[model samples]
Target: MSHGSSPSHLRGLAEVAAASVLWGTGGLAVQLIREHEAMSPVTISAWRMAIAAVVLLVALLAVRRAGELVELARSRPRQLLVVGAGTAAYQGFYFVSVTQVGVAVSTVVSLGLAPVLLTVAEAVRDRRPPAAGRLVVLVAALAGLLMVSVAGHASSTGPAPVAGVLLAIASGTTYALTTAAGGSISKESSPLVLTSGMTLVGAVVLLPCTALVDGPHVTTDAAALAWLAYLGVLTMALAYVLLYSGLRVVAPSTAVTASLVEPVTAAVVAAVVLGESLGPVAVVGILLVLGAVAGLGRPAAAAGPVLPDPDPVRPPTAP
Candidate 1:
């Protein structure tokens, strides 16, 4: 079915788009948090997940879907682990990548690689080649992402670019796994349940690491607390709700591709808020990324859903 003809798909697209835009703010938020709070990326990530988990649990209680979380934990413990572990890995890896290569490059590699990895995974699972048109869209989107990454200036504080790229690639793979698993889990339960489970799991996994590695570095300043709250509430909790809501109708690969808007948003924010300058190439790159997302938003006749199985067998779930 064409996204244009389906109201659900349209809603899904908007939901995903909104989530991506909000997520774009995360890099800046982290930067601000860093300015006020002296903490490791892992510690910040731990706080983000822990706070988001608590918020999600409260939201579930309010909506009376708290049982879904318990049911998922009882029934699909492994998938829950997968989603949660993937989330923790993505955040930790991506944030470290940011420190190593800077936000634009790390964001590019982390967000950019998910769609390609997911698309390839879908093609391999389906035992069929991706449609030529869809492949074109993916290529355009990736090319655009690369343009933005290469054109944007990296922060001077980072380490080797190669290491950062590797870390970002790992972040992308973890994110792809999370997105794929999320789509699968949402099929059997509500988005709220899936998000709650994942957030809790991620919190559980990261909280210890934060305490062990960054025990002496935790910050409790008011400004730091406020930034963490914003990251947890808007970027993590609310963003995942929109993400999973969109996954109900959109393919996981497409959803990640749609989220490429993140780098664009980050670039603009850097320019306007941070007083960073974007050259002509960066402007062109931004347009390409925007174009790629637009192409994905339109109706496509041959595309199919890309959702991983909740089970470890990795079957493609039906949309």
Candidate 2:
């Protein structure tokens, strides 16, 4: 069978989609945590990475996989540094952008821009333009994302719109670079090991920034602690594990496009959990995003096969 249609590729797509859904829940978790104890977004993000790194480390030690991490650190320190620092930078820029430009502008610009940039990068690397159908799908997804974001925050402009937009662009560019770097690294390392190492690096990179920006506030409330734990374990650790694993077999462009599921999942979660109503335009936007994702799922005949899974015989370890 063609690689694109192989079971491994489909599974990779599913993994990426699952990761995006988990990421969607992160905002809700943050909101709940803040309800119990006020905390700045940077502090919360720092805690999320730190906690996830710790949890992943404990799991690795328990499973006797710590040696793998050690080996990865010794062998691929540069890739780890790029991915880890890029991860923290993207999130930090995003939060600051949200404060300056508002959630809607930040969300639309940052998230929407990544896939486009990645797609263009892919095309440039391959010395060809994207397929017409793929371009159509990308446009639909971006338009849907814009609609959903604007509908959610129509009047939510921030203090400095231009600065926020620039920061958002930086955030998206950082995300694209990180994903591309991570995709390359995943081909040579176990996703679990990569996630643990990079997240630890990310925590280190973000901690001091968090302290400087938000004073590293710690939450003592039980409810907030639990929510923070959820953010760390599920959203940060597990979701990233899935992402890196999927990147091993999925094209970076396709993977980023699939991850547009994040906003759609967020919209649905808000409606059901937060009693937030999705207006008509937002609902249509959701459909468009879902449709675009579905369209992108089809095997691309023109694009070359994805990288073969390095350990296709080995089953995925539990995150």
Largest lDDT belongs to which candidate?
A: 2
TM-score: model 1 vs. ground truth: 0.88
Give the Cα error of residue 119 in candidate 1, in Å. 1.3
As a whole number from 0 to 100, the lDDT of residue 225 in candidate 2 is 95
Query: What TM-score do all the candidates reach, one by one?
Result: 0.88, 0.94
**Tens digit per residue, CA lDDT, model 2, 169-217:** 9999999889989998888778888899989999999888866764338
Candidate 1 per-residue lDDT, tens place, 186-230, comes to 667777778888899999999888766643456778988899999
Structure candidate 2, residue pairs in collision: none
Model 2 lDDT, full chain set: 0.86
**Model 2: residues >4 Å from true position, as ranges?**
1-4, 301-305, 312-319
